[model samples]
Target: MASKVIHAIYTDDDILLQAVKQVRAGRYHIAEIYTPFPVHGLDKAMGLEPTRLAITSFLYGLVGLAVAIVMMNYMMIEDWPQDIGGKPSFSFLSNLPAFVPIIFELTVFFAAHLMVITFYMRSKLWPFKEAENPDVRTTDDHFLMEIDVEDHDVNQLSKFLYDTGALEINLIDNK
Candidate 1:
């Protein structure tokens, strides 16, 4: 297979939208899009599915809550029951408010730590891993659209990008 460079046209939001619309209407293949920040409705425009990270965080928080409850109960009531400040440790149901702080801390701790781990894992980002950045400027103030042209007309694609008011155009070599 012959390796070819994919040219990306960078522009503002309006131009990006126009280019995306035209590409969609023409049924052109879009490789990827890079934006400085999350654009509203861009995911819908790109037909992306919702992220499941929030759900995963909730589940992990629940697990933390369970762990907090089990550990506290086992320590305070079952293994070594202790009476502090005249509060009875006979029942976990009683003085539940007292354990609220531990529960809350654990919930936040587990959710935050686990969610970060999950996000890194899912995104394939790991410690000491080299970051794959498309463009340094794109991280600050640029919108990039990458289109794959498989047996497609390069002139037509270039024209479309130019007509849409692309500020810059560059080709990416994909091996």
Candidate 2:
């Protein structure tokens, strides 16, 4: 089945944000938005759900912390008991203060790297992937809002978008 969509382009982010809110209030379903840069509160304006990446980051950090603790304990306490500064304490619990920095660093490192990987995977972004934006100009300076016009009147939608400050509007049949 073929579908038709409207691409509304805006020159500024502020206008785009307001247009999104107005369109949603008018019961129009927005397909997606493309912007040159991140617009603050744009997701909220578009009524998008909150991301779950932070929770996953915390879990990754915990795993990293556990790995760091176990690796440190095995290497420092069980494998080779180092008598540093003539203080020979072959116990992980007793010498935990000395491993605090390593634990913290590893936790942060794992969380940061894993979060980036997760984001890339979730967004389906990878090497050799083709660009999906309909307009290349959106990548430089324009903000675009795509609207599905499956059952809606294209003329009415175009008028509504134009009234909402869309700089340009184009109706395309996505077959």
Candidate 3:
């Protein structure tokens, strides 16, 4: 089976935003948009659901904090109790101030690194991944919008895109 899609290219981000709004207002479904840089408020403009990555990051941070606490307690208090600088090592609670920096660093490190990995995995991006943009120009200065052509009149869609200030319009058939 072959599916048809229209690719509309725009040179400016503002123009692309307006086009997206107009397309949505016209009840047309936009499959995706590609831009060289992040466009502010694009997710809201496209009606995309809110992301849950922040919650995941918080959970990762908590895990890191817990690991740091356990490791510090075992190494500094239980495993080998040592008074480094007149600070008592027998009680973990009394020496918690000294471990604050380590705990903070580990929490930030785990959250950042794990969040990046999660994003990559969620987006299916990895080493040797092929480019998915339909037009190479979209990787540079152009923005590309993909609209599904299911049961819609191609000519009308093209004209509407043109009226929305698309630089170039292309119809693609994917089988």
List CA RMSD, all candidates: 2.2, 1.5, 1.4
Q: List the residue pairs that clash in candidate 1.
A: none
lDDT of each: 0.80, 0.92, 0.94
**Cα-based TM-score, every candidate:** 0.88, 0.94, 0.95
Candidate 2 residue spans exceeding 4 A from truth: none
> lDDT rank, highest first?
3, 2, 1
Ranked by TM-score, top first: 3, 2, 1
Superposed model 3: Cα runs more than 4 Å off: none
How well is each residue in 98-135 modelled by candidate 2, as lDDT tens digits?
88999999999999999999999999999899889999
In terms of lDDT, which candidate is strongest?
3
Candidate 2 deviates by what RMSD?
1.5
**lDDT digits (tens) for residues 1-175 of candidate 1:** 2254455656577668767877777787777788887777777677678998999999999999999999889988899988899999899989688999998999999999999999989988988998666777778888888778777777877777777677776665677
What's model 1's lDDT at 122?
94
lDDT of 3 by residue, 40-131 (tens): 98899999999999999999999999999999999999999997989998898999999999999999999999999999999999989998
Task: Name the 10 consecutive residues with the lowest summed lDDT in model 1.
Answer: 1-10
